[model samples]
Target: MRIVEAIGIGVLILLAALALLFLRRMVITRRGGTIELGVRLSTMVPGRGWSAGLARFAGDDLRWYRIFSFWPGPRRVLSRRGLAVDRRRAPDAAERLVLPPDWVIVRCVTRRSPVEIAMAERALTGFLSWVEAAPPGESTPDTRPYRYRAG
Candidate 1:
């Protein structure tokens, strides 16, 4: 009887935690158009440093939040002024198994720092649009257009 009661309590706690995480995700996504993607936070190791995240385009800044986090703030914020697209590529065979079929990997260059963002094709389109958009008097990252290749 004691063992059964303990198991029941543990299951209830787990469910509550899951519900909280779901609520947090809903709140985060409700604020704006959030694009789901995988962000490489660092160059730790192969298939190790990548984390699933949600990115929101807020004017000149892109705010990224971890998908499965309890925090209410963005984990990273990238400014469009310093961001530039380096290249784009389709995920390899092993990565295809883990990520979505339509997802593409984009390498972004920002003040000598390189970051990789993996997102769906449509999301990539929206991201590129935002990166290219600017105010009437403000210029984009560069004058030359970026030719992206999916290799």
Candidate 2:
């Protein structure tokens, strides 16, 4: 019947729309990284809610993610210059998205470079722990040292 055919066409159109949306999100997500690690940024959502959802998502993902900061390390300090920097503007290279905050930034180094990812994992873990324990109005120190060092 014509109604049946129409319904099928409608369903196909809906599916195509969804697929395109997902693919677009994927492309947007994949746009940034570095020689050391590729970074991904999530859409700006409230930090608390986003963090909670990410913790749950990580339970299912092979790669782990956690909130992190650079602090208390002698070489690392938080300053305007240190946080979520665009990597491409460096003296030597073309433009690239270096470290945009994702609900999680996956360590995207070549599979051979397990060391790079491991270090990021450790720092992220420490930052997560710090955020959980930090009390209201407690001063959180800078994490620029560690982030800069990693880059």
Candidate 3:
């Protein structure tokens, strides 16, 4: 009986935590048109696949939070400066499972390292605009326009 009761309590706690996380994400999204778009991220490892997450534009940086994590803070932050968009393409067969439906993957190089992210076409446009929106008098990292490739 005690074991069963403990299990029930643990389940309840887990549910409560999940609810809190959902509420937090909702609040953040509701504030100031915070676009909570789905994205898939990839590192520099060869054959390393993509991981799903939610991305939002926060100030001059793009903040990424894992889809399954309960943490309130972003897992990765990509700065605007030193950001260069290399290319974009339609996701392949295996990538379809990890990326959002009808989204394209963008390859980019940041100050720290090279990273790839997938998002909807509209969101990708917005991201490019954000990167190029640096105010006058500030030095832009890569002047080349973002180019999309046929896949």
Candidate 4:
């Protein structure tokens, strides 16, 4: 019985060590701040009970996205210039989003404002509209001058 107990303790220690290593890896990646797009949202399960949707504008590409295990409510969105927040109501107030497998989160390393978010949403919608209406091989003009960068 004593020997069995000792083996169990050893296994528990090994599991704890592995868990620590995994956490460390995640921290290192976050610190790197080197993602393909400057604007990439790092989302987690919002809370015990909540769901929200996320959308990103890749210069006219309106990629409707979502996040899960995230929190909602009056949260500040950050950007390069500073905070351009919006007093959200209901759907707008959704800070934490529960995204589906098909959707993804595209957030900036920096904070953002409601205006910026609106702009991104608009641009993406417009771009999508144009793409649907345009000729098969034609490309739409990349009118978006601002680059979404997360700090």
Q: How does each model score on lDDT? A: 0.81, 0.30, 0.71, 0.33
Q: How high is each candidate's TM-score?
A: 0.85, 0.26, 0.80, 0.22
Which is the leading candidate under lDDT?
1
RMSD of each predicted structure: 2.4, 15.7, 2.8, 14.1
Overall local distance difference test of candidate 4: 0.33
Residue-wise C-alpha lDDT for candidate 1, range 19-133, written one tens digit per residue? 9889988887897778997888867656546789888878888999898888889998888777777789877766676678889899887765778989999898888888777
Q: Candidate 4, residue 89: CA error in Å?
A: 57
* Per-residue lDDT of model 2, residues 1-151, tens digit only: 9999999999999898777655543443353321122222333432211121012111112222233321211111122222221111121111112333331232232212211121234345544343234344543344122332223
Better of 1 and 3 by TM-score: 1
Quote the lDDT for 109 in model 3: 77
TM-score, cand. 1: 0.85
Clashing pairs in 1: none
> What RMSD does model 3 have?
2.8
Residue pairs in clash, model 3:
none
lDDT of candidate 4 over 41-82, digit per residue (tens): 333533222223333333323333233212322123232232
Deviation in angstroms for 55 in model 3?
Answer: 1.9
Error in Å for residue 130 of model 2: 17
